[model samples]
Target: MKLLLASSLALATVLGGGASAQTPPTRDPAQIQAGTYAVDPGHTQVGWRVSHMGFSNYAGGFSDVSGTLDLQPKTPATSKLSIKIPVASVTTTSDKLTGELKGDQWLDAGKFPEMTFVSTKVTPEGKDKAKVAGNLTLHGVTKPVTLDVTLVGAGVNPLNKKVTVGFEATGTLKRSEFGVKTYVPLIGDDLHLTIAGAFERQD
Candidate 1:
């Protein structure tokens, strides 16, 4: 009897652990709580793509991104956001091209070590989307840009029990407007940006 009882307990523990480990985040907007959230840099990414000499679209990305979100789900228009990206963290498949992009002829990471965006207005589009207009500063120039943002998910993280929210935003910009006109027509003047943002609610 003791052996059978022990086996049953062990089996139950294993099944319970497996179930919890497979839990997934919910997409319900009502589950989001109002609070200030800090960006989870480890899971966030910013990607950019541009046409290369009419041959193909070359892509690159920036890592080590950090940001903050003051969320008010009930009054989403009042929400605020800010993001900072290190110009030096930009990466591409080609080491030589990456180095050239960071030099004075391109982004000039040495002179402008950081790029930033601060939200000036937020307009809720539907139940789970919004239009975020902000001032983007890059290469020592600041210009107004807008992003169409969609909620990816929101729920309590199973491992950390922190309230977390995710979003994916898309936008377009002209490099010439920011004063980084290097190889404009050849490298493509219009740039497409995609951002995957993750934020964990602060206590």
Candidate 2:
């Protein structure tokens, strides 16, 4: 019985030492790099809301957005973003409204094909929040805009083993300032924009 007990103790000691000998789990190196990344259109969307006739709000979205994001996961305050949304990609459920939005009175898609935003600075507000200051160009006019940005989170893509980051940002723009002044009181001058984007790290 004593020999058996000694044998069990020796086995336990060997197992415990083996467990301690193993290397500690480490995070992905690619995640640490956090370089320039491209927007995955399939996983990104740009949405906007504006008042209609001063009574209700009308919501719409724009497809065909392209962008580049410069990220430093460890230093999010230094990150940068630049995105372009084609005016012609605007869509509404109402066919009439959709046509009108693409006409001369509104976006005038034919004349101005794109709206762009370029970030100038990023200020950290909290652990997952930031204030992004940028220049937004729309309808041939450029104006400074501020967006409240929140980092949704980031991780490795299980299927591809690539690093991906998600973010949510919101901002407001005055239509009149961008030459989108069609109806002064009828349509609200304030346009609220929400952006959700997922960026995939590039090799």
The top-ranked prediction according to lDDT is 1
lDDT score, residue 197, model 1?
Answer: 98
Q: Write down the TM-score of every candidate.
A: 0.91, 0.82
Question: Cα lDDT of all candidates, in order?
Answer: 0.93, 0.86
Candidate 1 C-alpha lDDT tens digits along 1-203: 99999999999999899777865776666767889999999989999999999999999999899989999988999999999999999999999999999999999999999989999999999989999999999999999999999999988777778889999999999999999998879889999999999999999
**Cα-based lDDT at residue 139, candidate 2:** 93
lDDT of 2 by residue, 39-120 (tens): 8887889999999997789999998888999987678778899999999989998999999999999999999999999999
What is candidate 2's CA lDDT for residue 12? 99
Query: TM-score winner among the candidates?
Result: 1
In model 2, state the lDDT of residue 137: 95
Q: Which ten-residue region of model 2 has the weakest summed lDDT?
A: 23-32
N/CA/C clash count, model 2: 0
Judge candidate 1 against the unseen true structure and give its global Cα lDDT, from 0 to 1: 0.93
Off by over 4 Å in 1: 1-23
Q: What range of 10 consecutive residues in model 1 has the weakest lDDT sum? A: 22-31
Query: How far does residue 62 in candidate 2 sit from its true spot (Å)?
Result: 0.5
